[model samples]
Target: MAERGRDEESGKFTEEYPKEDFIKALKELESTGTTDIAESVGCDRRTAYLKLNILEEENKVESKKIGNVLLWELAVESV
Candidate 1:
């Protein structure tokens, strides 16, 4: 579930989506762009990148640099 927030002054709505949700989204995404990750989780790009890096360190995700864009994918387990 995502936490909802609203600014009193600007009346802008914000959602603090859970990282666990992103993990599930990443697994379903399989392979996708960096922006896609953020969009999937309703989080900012920087946050998505940070989480992906953490996942990479945890051996849960993989990344590849293709030209200027970095592609991310779920790490597959051996049968």
Candidate 2:
């Protein structure tokens, strides 16, 4: 389920979509842009971008920029 909470900085309600939704989206899409990710995960583009950044920081996913768009995919594990 999505969680709605107040943003400390803005004091406005914010909705948190599940990280699993993102992971699953990446799995299904293989590689995609933020707009596609948002659509697949049922959220807005900004939310998808933020979550993708978090996942990138955690090393769970990787990304590369192609012209003006960023392409995302699950991280490849090395042995």
Candidate 3:
């Protein structure tokens, strides 16, 4: 058990997402749409949409439709 715990602590079971990467992804998402955002972030389109929805619900971001595409952007001033 102790060996297993050490192995986990050694980064085998840890997944870290950098804040900078997340911010960059958010900016890219804002510039593009869900599909582009997913590609840029190295995630699936569905996951990208889900993340965008969560951010929107948290008032951290907003989305708008331009033509047939939906674009996301960070909310500078939260309500």
Candidate 4:
């Protein structure tokens, strides 16, 4: 089992959260920045990016440049 540690910021025991949790969070938003995703999921920005990377690789998400920031959203499908 992974060792549990108290998070410095939340002071709560931190455990592994599945990547799907991030995906679910992203689906609820039309578009979002990296920091917003981290805040929404109660994780660090780096973890959020990691999950986003996986989602992008799986073609579940897409991103576009908006100014200097990247906005990500669920990939749209066409019939």
Q: Highest lDDT among the candidates is held by which one?
A: 2
Task: Give the C-alpha lDDT of model 1.
Answer: 0.79
Summed backbone clashes in each candidate are 0, 0, 0, 0
lDDT of 2 by residue, 1-79 (tens): 6567998999988656878889999999988999999999989899999999999998998999999999999999610
- Of the two candidates 2 and 3, the one with more favorable TM-score, higher being better, is 2
Worst 10 residues of 2 by lDDT: 70-79
Candidate 4 positional error at 23, Å: 1.6
Tens digit of per-residue lDDT, candidate 3, span 46-77: 87787778777877778899998988777787
> Please, what is the TM-score per model?
0.70, 0.77, 0.63, 0.71
Q: Candidate 4 on 54-77: residue-level lDDT in tens?
A: 888888888888899988888775
Error of 1 at 26 (Å): 1.6
TM-score (C-alpha) between model 3 and the true structure: 0.63
Cα error, candidate 4, residue 13 (Å): 16
- Off-target runs (Cα >4 Å) in candidate 1 are 1-17
**Model 1, residue pairs in steric clash:** none
Clashes counted in candidate 1 amount to 0
Best by the TM-score measure: 2
Q: Which of the predicted structures, 2 or 3, would earn the higher lDDT when compared with the native?
A: 2
The reply for model 2, stretches above 4 Å from the true place, is 1-15
